[model samples]
Target: MYQIIVGIDEDEAHAKLCAEEVVGMPGDGSEKHVTLIHSFTDNPSGASATQLAPVREASDVLDEAGIDYDVTESSGDPAEAIIDAADDVDADLIVIGGRKRSPAGKALFGSVTQTVILNAGRPVMVTGVPEDA
Candidate 1:
């Protein structure tokens, strides 16, 4: 079986974009499985990973594609969480969404996507973050 891990933030459009990419990956849906990971800074409302808006949006796409998927949650650093989740699942590829940013802008604000790409120690697929994100 081929395994994929997708990192989802609060952006529904980006999540859906990544999910669609996974849907188009080479394989019959039966041979693939996706894991959606989300790291929350804080959960004042205490929502499960599956309950998050972006995750649910991604899940919907996976469902329609006849792909199998699971949800994973973390409470701290997003890049670390995504990498750890990928490692835990022994994922074949790690997926994430990112907006185009200048090198200076990324250096100033820091990018979880950049960090994951640099440190994942495996293949990473980046999806274009939508304007709404």
Candidate 2:
């Protein structure tokens, strides 16, 4: 079974969606081990506190579905934290949320998802959220 690591961000809706996708992944008829990972920055003024909530919500769903998973929390740049977590668990897949960034923003500071997609040695999945979310 594939070991999946879903990258969770501060957005609840995006996280929930990613979690759902993880829960729905076909197990090749075998049970897959999933790891829900959320990264937070040291900046309390930021959305760090809410970053891991999605994993908690996702955990409830996994529990109800009888799927097995472990949740992890880390502090640092989101991309780095996610990569590190995946490595820690030897994950076969890394799922993350995708966002649209302004041209200037993308040029000045690369998006985390972009960096992860470019660098993660393992397979990665990117999911988008509803427009209202």
Candidate 3:
């Protein structure tokens, strides 16, 4: 079974993009699974994973593509939560949204994406590419 840990933030567009990538994954078997992780730095309302808009949107994309996923809500550092989920699932790949680069080629990544890219033991795929690229 192929396992993927998708790090989804508050942005629905990013989450959709991440899920679109899932649809393009190499495998077609029902064995392919995705672990959706949404990290909340602070929660005043005490929302669950299923309550988040981004997670729900991502789930919609996954559902349309017939991909299976499990939601995991975490509190604390997003990178840490994603990494831990990856470790827990022994994920084959990690997916996260990334920042687009400036025309001068200066690209800034979100801290969570940067951290995951630098520290994850497994492969990390950052979604969103510069238009020119």
TM-score of each: 0.95, 0.82, 0.87
lDDT of 1 by residue, 1-133 (tens): 9999999999899999999999999989989999999999999999998998889999999999899998989999999999999999899999999888999999999999999999999999998867665
lDDT of 2: 0.76
The CA lDDT of each predicted structure is 0.93, 0.76, 0.87
Highest-scoring model, TM-score: 1
The CA lDDT at 75 in model 1 is: 92
Ranking by lDDT: 1, 3, 2
lDDT of 3 by residue, 1-133 (tens): 8999999898888888888888888878376799999989989998898998989999998898788899998899999999999999899999998865553543433477778998999999998743433
The prediction achieving the highest lDDT against the true structure is 1
TM-score-based ranking: 1, 3, 2
**Candidate 1 minimal-lDDT segment of 10 residues:** 124-133
